[model samples]
Target: MAASAGPVLSREEVDRALARLGAERDAVESALLSLQDHPGLRLLDGADLTGRTQERWAVVGQGLPMLWALFDRYSEALASARAVRARKPRPGGPELAELSELLTGDAVTVPGGAPDGPQRLGAPARLVERVSLDGLMDRMNAWYATVLEVVSAADAVWTALPARIDLLIAELRRVQTLAASLGVRVGGHPLGDDLDALDADLGGLRTEVRSDPLALWRPARVPAQRGTVPDGGALATPSGVVDTERFDLAGRALDGVRLELENLLRLRDDAEERLQGVGDLLQRADATLAEARRARGEVLAKIAATEVPAVPGPASALRERIVVALELRQSGQWYRLAPLLDALEDAAAKELARARQSLTEVTQPLAVRAELRGRLDAYKAMAARLRVAEDPEVVERYEKARWLLWSAPCDLRAAAGAVARFQQALRPAPGGPDDGAATGPADLVDAVDAVDAADGTQQGGAWAGGEPADGQAVDGRVQGGRG
Candidate 1:
């Protein structure tokens, strides 16, 4: 219902509008310069952008020059109006009428005018119906805003991606060097192959990201609320989103390499421990063999009748294996050294145990003779305490056992039988004339008899009250049954 024409301005109103117009021009000029000098805009101009960013920038590039052209036209119109008012001390009715038209009316003119009239800057084909000074300013502000969106998006992608890629590349190189030192070849270890593949992939991905950042960006659509008519929504941001999945994959690959390195270091430590154990076992075996050799000479000289086993010499073959294992450890072949050290440790322990067994076997008869001598004297002292050392049968058996046991080239088999017979004589005769209160000697005899029973002997008369000298009922004859 309002008139199509602009409202008329008095002199004061014209002057006020001019001041306001000049302020708008200054602000607009500052905005234009800032947009032109913006880092994002500079990057957008020089960068080899791609995909949606490339397409959008092409449109923005075309629109930018048109926006500048329109701003120039707006500036010229304001200047001409200001000059007309400056000619008089005060604007008259005629002067005010002309100023009113310039201040509020359609004032911007396109140079090389269209066949119809003034037009939008770049779209000369579509003639502009009418544009006032204020309308032109609004159009320029819109163009500036749209161009800034594209420029900022490109700059944001550039800022976040390239530096991150460089850091990842540095980490990848460090891992690659470590892998090579560990003998992890591309075709040998799966992790090595994976690292190699990642190297190639990261190289290509970095190039792609640098050259065409927008192509890698993901666009997420925010869901509209239910039960509301959805308006055409602007994007949350025009900037490219980083390809986080690829970066995470790269980080995971490096972590795997780091884990492998840790495992190898642990293996190296275990290998060193195993080598130390192998050395200890081999040294113990050598010492055991030396002791066995010394015992062999003593056994031959003292027990003339016994055949001594020859002490085995140090295990030269096993020693050679230890040398080889040590070499493997020095060479950093932890995998190879681990199994070798295990085998060497087992073999060395067996050799040491065998040497000890040989020494025990070769000197066994001498030990038995010594044991028999002590048993004979122990029973003699026992019988003397019991007032029965002068028993003729016991003396005869004792002397026979002693001579066989004490003489060099002692017949140990005969000596063992003599000692057993002497021990049997020391037992109290069942229903024979040897009854009295039990003494310490009888208790000692019972203790020796208990030992004999454990060795599968069934002695007839060791205890004064007899149940075959033990608690067992023997052959239905209970000589000393509990009352």
Candidate 2:
């Protein structure tokens, strides 16, 4: 019997085991105390928790007392072994046997064996339940870990979401105040009914997050095997754990409201400037139309046998729309005024452009008649410069051309033809290059006819009154020139 027991543990081995067990008892005690002092645990204890955390905490709360009870039992068991081992420097076989049983055998008795209530209500239980030192430690570790996980997850949400929700709610109030000042309206309500609804809902959402923070708990994207507090909480970060979908929705809605308010405020600032721009455009358009009407009358009085496009009247409709838009802006109906001003500005710009175009078209006939008059005078000057001003054919053609040019309501085509004839009569006519290249008045008439035909129809060759270009000629004598 002595040999069997001595082989179980030598003196040094028995002392080593007691020291290790004592260290383990101290470690377990420290761990439990730290858990009790944990901020997450204290908050969970005080909070009126809701949802899954509420359900799980009820189970954890009951086990706390039993957990302490089990620790006391473990400590007592360690104390007995320590006392026996301390009795003498070298313990005898009976003392070693007792120490061995206390340390290694099933030494702690628990009344129900379960910290929780019995599994079956009416079922009979054993008279006694005994657990080894290792078994009790394992059970306590499991109970401690289970309780802390619930506490940590709940604390993670409480700490993160309510603060964010408060900030969002405060921002909503600012948006509301700014909207009121801007006179911003959406669909008959202030900032639309949704913003109001969100304002109200966000206040309630904050309360919901307080009571039911676990509902917002979600798994991390990478799903860490363990977490920060080491309670096996799996909340890699408190911020990462909250499912902020509602908070994010509220934020988006609030941002939209702020952005819209900013746009309306800018519109209010720029409204007068934009309206002034439109008014200036309308004034310019009206002035342009007046100028066009006067030009139309001048073209009719001064030019003959030419078509002039008539000017449309000033854009009265755009002016009326601008007036309505100004009234809407003054009344602070920015929603109505915004689109109206946009259309008004566009129409006013187009009206200004249209007025300018009308002025250009209306004066075109006068411009053409002036060009013909200038051409007739240029040819007459060329005749005088060439010293043929008094030749009878030249004089006759000049008188006819002068009659057409000087007369009001001139026939420009007949005048242009008469000028061409007079011009041809001034210049010596083309014959063969070897014939000293001169022909009489009938040939001059034929040359004028050729010029009128080419100018009126086909390209190439006119009476330039110069030597032919490219060694080519009109009837082998003249090169075409711009008149």
Candidate 3:
């Protein structure tokens, strides 16, 4: 009995103990792998396992419970291996080296185990102690084959779970970026609530797995077979366990991605629609502006046509007469034809008035043109008014002035120029004599009164010349006498 007992272990026996555990893990792993190729071991049917395997028809129902137990045990061993790996001392440490040796080398005896004897698995009544490699391999292989079927069935569910999560994360980032660009919050229906839910579920699953990965080692209870221990529930069975919750999470993530993508597509569609409408509106506005410009051009053309022909004739005649009068006066001969000179001044004034009026009328269309000029000036003034103006009022006043200059009823400057021209034409010729006997003043006043009465009509027709009333030229040069 003493020889059968294993070597004793101490507090510092951690390395040796871990090494033994590793050997045991490896032994189980090898046995499970060998069993994969075994024959005559019937796969468990409905009685085999839980979760996904029970639905198959080829596996025997009687072998399911054992298979379930075998797989459960295998899961436990795998989880232990992961835990031990996590806790192993640093590389190059004696403990780590011991664990490595146990994993790849011969089994080590520890605590109560025999140093050179076969390892005792457990109490003889609890489990078979010296299972034949061939026999056990055959049994495990049959059981695992059924579990492999379960693994295949659950593959999409398991694999898709994490994939869905990854996709969800990517979509979430995309939505966040889009929301930022549009200057909107992310709390609305697009991906907000769904993302929140998925995040929470994923966090919970991660926490659960971190807390105890071995929790999955327990056999899953089938909804239909509540209390029965299926044969396939054995930990040593070759059943592949999948993280189903991960699949669920992934499904949700995929759903979120789909929804988010749909939202993005809709946003694009809406932007396109708005852009189309804006384009149409701009086209209409451009067309309207073009028509207005054409109309303005036509108006200006008419004014020019009316005023052009009359300009040269009257203006030139008046200038020539003024020059003649000035020359006569400078030669000290103006007293003889003082009345004629006065008449000339009056005629000159009338001609100037007409010229001015024609010019004013021709330029009236420019007020509309001036409107555009004023707007441009207003834009220029915007920078200067920042300091002097309290607000935009100065800018506005400047704009209004410009509008007045350009808009319909001609500007004050235009009207004033016309009046000034008329007044200038009424002035007595500079070299003419200022004698009381002259009817020049009276005739000129009457002419102005007539013009005033006619609402300042532009003079174009011949004037009524003042003479001796006997058909004699007042200045001895009668060449129609301004009539």
Candidate 4:
């Protein structure tokens, strides 16, 4: 941004400035030459670029010729200055001033922003342009930097994202092959659909990254880093090189598909064990069902006027499905087996839970009687603690409830009503510390104890022997549903 037209120089200073101009001319030419041959620029030149890169690079391509023309103009001006100096021995004031202006002032005429060559930077609308020697050098510096920015940013993205995507594509190929061998699917859709989508997205991304990399960059608030050309001199710093959010998304999606395929492969390795576990769960379910049937008989004999839920037959169908799963596993049809195993395992677990629940249902009346008895005793204890046991209403209700509860073949529905009556009389009377409010009943029967009547519950019921929660395989044995 700084452009200074320096004061008149001495002859030696003028000569030094000219020599410096020559050095600067060489530096500019080298920078431009390197840019012309840069691989990234070559790609840009041929590619049908899109988006912001298309717009910006078009300006660079058009503007490029002006740089060469200006460089030519600078050389001629230097040659003319040299010729004048050589005309007089130990040149005087006029020769020195002319040399001084040629070194520091806008002493050259360059091609304009016309139809043929690169445009003058700011005055794109102008046909002709003039800049001092220092100005010409500065212009080339800025122009070279711009060219590098486009070329470097595009190459950076090409380097960063495409190679990773290619590696992912390679991994994807392996996954696809594995999936095809096993006939795997993701949520009922073949992996080919995902592969197609991934190919389209990543392929499009690679092309776009090559052609229009600037579109992927983050907007830079600060200026890009100025770099020296490989040969010599400065080039423009490339702006916001690569923003990988899109690339990252595509990569993760690809990984997810690959992981899904891998999971199916793993399922093949352990399908037999998994099927065996399912068999174990079904066996446990059968045992629990038998226990429920036995318990129902006991409930019918012991609890009067109580309904017991019917126990289902053994979970033979679920166990039978294991044969099919084994066949699939043996054939390496992992996709089919994976879903089947999922359904079969789920069914086995529910069967166990259902069997346990049936046992609980059949024996529910006995549990109710026990719960009512406990509540009755709790209320009695609370009454004694409150010194209300002697209240005639409490005494009468408690005795009647106790008689029914203690009887064999207890009518639980009637007995429950009697307990409720006993509890009603135990409420605090109005106009005391109680103030007519019924103090809540004691913490009795808050929960019906988990009625696991199966052979060995979790403590002694369903899926005994360190039950695996949810029909999961444990030590190659499936166990779950401690009800």
Best by TM-score: 2
Ordered list by lDDT, greatest first: 2, 4, 1, 3
| Between candidates 2 and 4, the TM-score winner | 2
lDDT of 1 by residue, 257-313 (tens): 768765766767787777777778778777777777776676676665456678888
lDDT for model 1 comes to 0.66
lDDT of 3 by residue, 343-420 (tens): 654564455455444444433444423433433343334323223223254445444544544455433333223333
For candidate 2, lDDT tens digit of each residue in 249-309? 8899889878977888888889999999999999999999998898888778866766768
Per-candidate Cα RMSD to the true structure, in Å, reads 10.9, 8.2, 28.8, 13.5
By the lDDT metric, which is better: model 2 or model 3?
2
Reference-based TM-score, model 4 = 0.61
- The backbone clash count of each candidate, in order, is 0, 1, 43, 10
Candidate 4 CA-lDDT value: 0.67
Model 4: pairs clashing at backbone N, Cα or C within 3 Å: 63-118, 105-132, 106-131, 106-132, 145-236, 430-436, 456-460, 456-461, 457-460, 457-461
* TM-scores of all predicted structures: 0.53, 0.76, 0.24, 0.61
Q: Which ranking of candidates, highest TM-score first?
A: 2, 4, 1, 3
